[model samples]
Target: MQWDGISEFVYVAENESFTRASKKMAISTAQVSRQVSALEKRLNIKLFYRTTRKVSLTEEGRVFYQHCRSVLDGLDAAEHAITNLHSKPQGKIKLTAPVTYGEQQVLPLVNNFISQYSDIEVSAYLSNRNIDLVDEGYDLAIRLGKLSDSTMMAKKLGKRTSYVCASPRYLEKHGVPHALSELSQHSCLLGTLDYWHFSELEREKSIRVSGRLRYNSGFSLTDAALKGLGIVQLPDYYVEQHIKNGELISLLDSYRAPDEGIWAVYPQNRHLSPKIRLLVDYLAEKLR
Candidate 1:
């Protein structure tokens, strides 16, 4: 089987235009058409449905394209690994993390990493949304809490615990809740999640919370809590310093859930890049 035909076919499928594919592959239009035709003839199937205006993949073409894409991805990974085998970590690393954590922790570490490895560049996207690492072309991501994607590889960076807290003024105005059930009596400043984490006799629990003011940002929720609007459940990074400064008082300590693991997640590619591996290690060490 000729590899050129497969490459041409994939490129054509992606662009949906023979001319565009030819340009992208730096080959003539005749060459691109010849290779794709050769592939279809060899496979004994129609790969594309062509009209005067556009090209569309046939059902068979779509199936073939999926397999071809995976093959091309593997080939690219192999080439990347081979090229960087002995080289210092160089090139751009695209990473994503939750906005608050990125600004508070990951950004500083990434700054330090670039300072140490002068050849490497970093691009970070701080978002609360769970980004598709492969589709988004990200090298790695820093994920907090539990990981649900079994397909990705995760390295534990450290642990973060949730803090249920309120300002002294709020506690004084509204008597502190003594137990989980008592949370219903006091207004709870809700964050993005619908439930607040807790622990009961070694078992993790999530209690549904409500508030007069609901916010998606931890900073906003903490600020609301500071102004005595309501109680808030937040990660330690947002509330720890305030707890020390007597701006916020930790509540329901006995029911505080087990610490959640912070992870550096990446695609489970066969050849993980050195830049990603080393950065994950650096973050783990610094966070620990």
Candidate 2:
């Protein structure tokens, strides 16, 4: 059987829908159906039990699927190895990160890297939603906070310290909060993480703070705080320039927020491309 047929079969089995498999493979649905049919004809057995709503593998199909998936995976590894041997890194590298961080931080570094390496092409997806790197064929991702994905390798770039702050005008109007308990009396601008934590003395403490406005985007909340709407807790990178310019002021100096780490993550099994490795190292150096 053609290797292409085997690959298509594996995709179909994993997705359980010819239409979905076709989209992923970048082929027509009819082509996917025909390849599976031809494979079934050659094997002289039904591979899939198909209904109008769903498709499931038959007994023979289950055994064939395991072997097909292994073969396809091995073929991908071989291709990556062959590409790496050519000396120059050349190919598309797909990456993802949070919207604001990707725009303000990752894009500049990516531009510098792309300028130096003309052969390497890069595509970046900026969203907060967690992406499946292997399943979606992404080369790598930049993630913040704690990582729980055991299947991927995480290279931590550095840690970002968060600050609680507000504009001088807002502080003058509402008065500065002397302690964590007094936050309830102020008009706080909350972000995705509602519960704030701080390192006091030798221990870390956390408290859930509510506000009149809650925003999903850190950029939005920072903007509100800049306009003297309310106090906001945000990363240092997001507010450092503003604070320096006297547009915002830091508060609760004695209590330090827990530091969040940034990481470069990729699937564990795939060969690390020279281009991706260089970019990751470059970012770690620049961010540090």
User: What are the models' TM-scores?
Assistant: 0.71, 0.70
In candidate 1, stretches whose alpha carbon ends up further than 4 angstroms from where it belongs are 1-86
Each candidate's clash count: 0, 0
Write one digit per residue (lDDT tens) for candidate 2, span 1-288.
455467678778877899989998899999999989988988889999999999999999999987876676677778877877768877788999988889999999899989999999999999888999977889999999999887688999988888899999999999999798898898888887778878778688887888889998788888999999999988988888899999999998689767889999997655577788889999999987
Q: Which run of 10 residues does model 1 get worst, by summed lDDT? A: 267-276
Global lDDT of each model?
A: 0.89, 0.87
With a 3 Å backbone cut-off (N, CA, C), the pairs that clash in candidate 2 are: none
Model 2: residue 76 alpha-carbon error in angstroms: 12
Model 1 reaches what TM-score against the true structure?
0.71
Query: Which clashing pairs does model 1 show?
Result: none
lDDT (10s digit) by residue, model 1, range 120-140: 889999998999886577889
List residue ranges in candidate 2 displaced over 4 A. Answer: 1-86
